[model samples]
Target: MTAAFVAGVGMTKFEKPGKREWDYPDMARESGTAALADAGLEYGQVEAAYVGYVYGDSTAGQRAVYELGLTGIPVVNVNNNCSTGSTALYLATQAVRSGQVDVALALGFEKMLPGALAAGYEDRESPLLRHLLALAELEEFAMPAAPYMFGAAGREHMRRFGSTPEQFARIAEKNHRHSAANPYAQFQDIYSLEQIQAAPMIYDPLTKLQCSPPSEGSAAAIVVSERFLDANGLRDRAVEIVGQSMVTDLASTFEAKSAITLVGADMSATAARQVYAQAGITPDQIDVIELHDCFSTNELLTYEALGLCEEGQGSTLVDADATTFGGQVVVNPSGGLISKGHPLGATGLAQCAELTWQLRGTAGDRQVQGATLALQHNIGLGGAAVVTAYRPAS
Candidate 1:
């Protein structure tokens, strides 16, 4: 297949919209407009569109597209939990690469409500729910709520790798500080390490500070064929999508595996390896990375899983400031899901947007200098993972 290129990307500040305020369609339209403007193209130029969303009901994409003036193009709605955005982008990229379309748009939007987690299965009393609940209660004391699951993961990391709670807090503090420089980040106030540690504990080692707040936001991007890029005189500015891969594992039975043996990590690593092979770049060649840091521990483990560091050596890298903005490899310069806010479906696209900016040297204060190579990683429910490698246009 031919390689696809990212023509443009856009996102709104991750923040809460007032009650009865801007809805999902509004967010989608705004992000789509911004993406088109960034691409130096008009909305009419788009040949097809893919929208990523989890909670929104049917016709979400149609409603959003209607706001931008309908072109009667093919509009697909995708739902894949946190990996929704990346999945949509993947399909769009495939379409362009297959010569099915010249230019396609991938948009992700979410407006999450704050509350207890609910199973997305059809029947609330389904046997699947019972089985999942039993497994969650067996290994982890609490039902596998997102923040709680991450906390359990953090606790396991501590036990196995000697990762201190303070070290995890430090990750939160760093991201908060980075977010302060990002006007688009949801939480812009910098938090001290002590402040992060002092925050009320949501789940045993993971404090409130470490948890990503429920957010409402959107992100969008345009992917184009190489021929389209050359025809539009955008080759020099485009970001090359060198590699993309996705993997899935048994989610409900994850607890049966040892804490140190993360199926998600293995799946993500396989995807990353494929991406690296296709890009002809090693982990050391990556100057910037944006991984799913829904919690601090996730970020640390991701380092090892992505081959950025050896297994059990992730904390050492963090301690040495190797993943800081100016470090050997800048991770989450957009503040990540930690401080950048996680809007479910919007997050994966947000990561891609941030990486694109980094590659173009347009990340402002959070910019990583000379970021020629970048990576974006996203994980989904049931331990699915996707990794994509990118390089700046020569």
Candidate 2:
């Protein structure tokens, strides 16, 4: 396969559901316009498009992209739970890498309702049936599915690893502080650790502030093959996707009898390992990262899963402050889902856009100094984790 480069990326400022006056199509148009402008290309140049959203009717992709242009390009609608955005990106990158298309567009958006996320269809079988069963086997549901599952994982971490509620609260504190510099973040106000800890608890270790709110936003990225980059003089502006992989749940997801594994830590580990092997680099070589942090506990669990530390040692890393701006690898410099907002379909591509900006040295105040290699991890509990490694185009 040939190399696929992120020629350009863009996203709307994430907002609370009712806070925005626009809809998905409006978000799509604004984001698509920015991406095209950043790429210095027309919508007509896109040979195929992959659009993602979790809450929308069929053919919403076409409706979204029609606002960009009626180019009649192939528009594949994608939904892989919360990882939907990166799922689209994975397919777009594959299209370019396979020489099926010189330039493909990856777009994702979500205009979610306010309040705790609930099932959209109660009449049908839930996609999370197996996951729910796994949760039942471990403990009773304490909160909504998201908080309950992730909080259980965190509770298990505390039991086994000697991690603390204070440690998890610190993750939220760091991310909120990081978001203060990010204009695109939905919640940019920094909160102290005590302030975060004081917030009402949703599920034990996870306070209300540590949970990602239902958000409204969109993000897009233009993936191009090397030939297109060379033909369009795009090297200086492009960021190469050095390696990428998408993995699903394994037997360990259930059989391990571990909430951490049940919540997709193993899948994340597998995906990260595949990405590292593809990039021929170790976790220590990564200068920055943007991983799924729907809850602060997941962030700590992911540290071990990504090989940044050994299992049960995530709190140690947290104590060392190794994953923040002045530390070894700056994790979630864009504030992550906790503070950046998690609009399901938009989260992964938002991660991509932030990392691309980091690679190009354009992330401004939240930028990690001398960043060269970056990693992105986006996962959905129904079982999908997309991991991508990136570097500036040569």
Candidate 3:
């Protein structure tokens, strides 16, 4: 086995669904070509590719990569729902680390519909049926499934830890402010906490602004073996992936009958523990992070899961300004899914791209000062949680 590094990263500006006339392949071509250009490598140098998209047909990965080049290399298609983007990245990094390929391309894109997310197939059984059933056993809701699950989590946090709706609204306020500086974020306008709280409610504690919207975008990264980096004199530009872990649902997911558990708090906590141990670092040592924020409630729940704060104390982190820029750790400087836009398959790589830029001191206005260590957390209910740590290449 060998070390793997993210040599280059790129992304298309996230857009409102239906705002662009482009297809998935076009989005992939733009982001993939930008990544290769960033790495100063040709598409032909990529020995393998993993492309992720949830709303596409078979061979979509091949079609998308074909727009970049017909290098005749192996292409793997991935669809892990919302975590699909990061899952592709995980596979690509593993390929380089395992010495199966000196360099690999990780690409993800999604062309989504303009409104709330819905199941693609109502006829067949849904992969998330089990997750929903778990939710049903715990509580009932007449609202949208995704929002209810997260909102219920918020409700649980409030019930257990005394967190307030205002605290969750503050999270949305902070992310919207952060997105104002992000050129690729779907929503850049900052909103007041009062305004956010006053927005049309999607679920009890979750307002429309508090939940991530359906978005369309693409993001890409080039993973290279240490040997490849040295050979190409790319070490100076590489960001080493020092630690990574992926975990799925556990017995705690449903046995506890807790919304927090059902929405992957346990998986996230388990994966983060593994990642921290693997990287030989602690949450306090992470200078920046890009965790999943599909809903603001999940962000609060993740705070405890990632060990950034104690369980039932996530609100303190928010109240103390410990998770924002110039705070203890800058989390979601990219505006996260809420504002950056959750394009499902593209989100994980988008976070990878953002963190890679931060590590490289190239994040422009949203840069976290002295960011030597970064963390990424992407989760998809069904469910999978991928946690990774990145640091400047040694």
Candidate 4:
């Protein structure tokens, strides 16, 4: 297979919705311009584009990309729930790797409504309708769908394993502390574990601080083939996409009747394993990571899923400080969705942008020392997980 490289990445500082006079087009133009500038290329050089968003109407992708230029390139609109941004990235990677296009753009943005996520088309048969019904059968649908679902997963982790709510709060604390150095993060104020645990509880073990707030932001990345990189003198800045994989819900998502599986732990694990195998890499080789920490519990759960530690040992990893700076491997150096903000479509691409900067040793204050290999994990609840591995082209 041909190789694909991330030549550049850009992201907008996440903000509360309606806080600024900006619209999605403004976001698209800002982030898109930054990414192109970072790559030292013009929009005309892009052969195709994948634009992702979750809240807009049809052709939102077209309207957004038009902000970059009127270039008549193929523009594909993508929406995979929270994984929407990464889904565009996944397609962009495939486009370059498959030789479909030498230079492809992956752009993602979201101008979200404030507050918790809810389905827009309530009249229509919701994709999660059956899921809600099945969940009721499996576990008590005690709280709102998202929090309860994940909180139940955390509870099960405690019931089966020995994870504690304090451990979960500690994860949030770490992410918040990490966010203090990220200019793109939504909430950068450091919070103690006590503060995190004391924040208004969203669910049993999940606090309001643990949940990612709706955000307005955008992110973009330029993916190119080796030939294009060499031709454009971009090899020095290129970050190779050594391997990538996207996995959907497996049979255990429903058959096994476990909150952990329903919330995408299995799918994430499966995707990460495939990416590692495809790249001939291992978790121990990943010096840095940017993963889907939509909730702190998911971060802990993902630890085991990504093979960072043994199953039922995520709390132990947390205790050892193995996931933070000066630890085994730096995870979520960008503060993750928990503090960085989750703009659905933009979340994945933002992770991509952060990792690209880390691999290039340009992450500034949050730079992960000697980061040779970087891993990305992005997952959506309706079941999609995209895992990608990156290394410098040099």
TM-scores of all models? 0.94, 0.99, 0.99, 0.99
Candidate 3's clash total is: 0
Model 1, position 243: C-alpha lDDT score: 92
Task: Kindly list the per-residue Cα lDDT of model 3 for residues 99-171, writing each as its tens digit.
Answer: 9999999999999987777888879998878878878776786557889889988998999889999999999
Q: What is the lDDT, from 0 to 100, of the residue 79 in candidate 3?
A: 93
Model 2 regions lying over 4 Å from their true place: none
- Mark the regions of model 4 whose C-alpha exceeds 4 Å error after superposition: none
TM-score attained by model 3: 0.99
Any idea how many clashes model 2 has? 0
Query: Model 1: runs farther than 4 Å from truth?
Result: 17-20, 120-138, 250-256, 260-263
For candidate 1, the TM-score is 0.94
For model 1, how does the per-residue alpha-carbon lDDT over 125-152 read when each residue is reduced to its tens digit? Answer: 6423433454365355574366656666
Each prediction's total of clashing residue pairs, residues at least 3 apart in sequence or on different chains, is 0, 0, 0, 0
Candidate 2 on 1-394: residue-level lDDT in tens? 9999999999999999999699999999989889999999999999999999999999999999999999778999999999999999999999999999999999999999998888989899899988888788888866588899999999999999899999999999999999999999999898999999999989888999999999999999999999999999999989999999999999988889999998899999999999999999999999999999999999999999999999999999889899897787999999999999999988999999999999999999998989899999999988899999999996
lDDT of 4: 0.92
Each model's RMSD to truth, in Å? 2.3, 0.7, 0.8, 0.9
Of the two candidates 1 and 2, the one with more favorable TM-score, higher being better, is 2
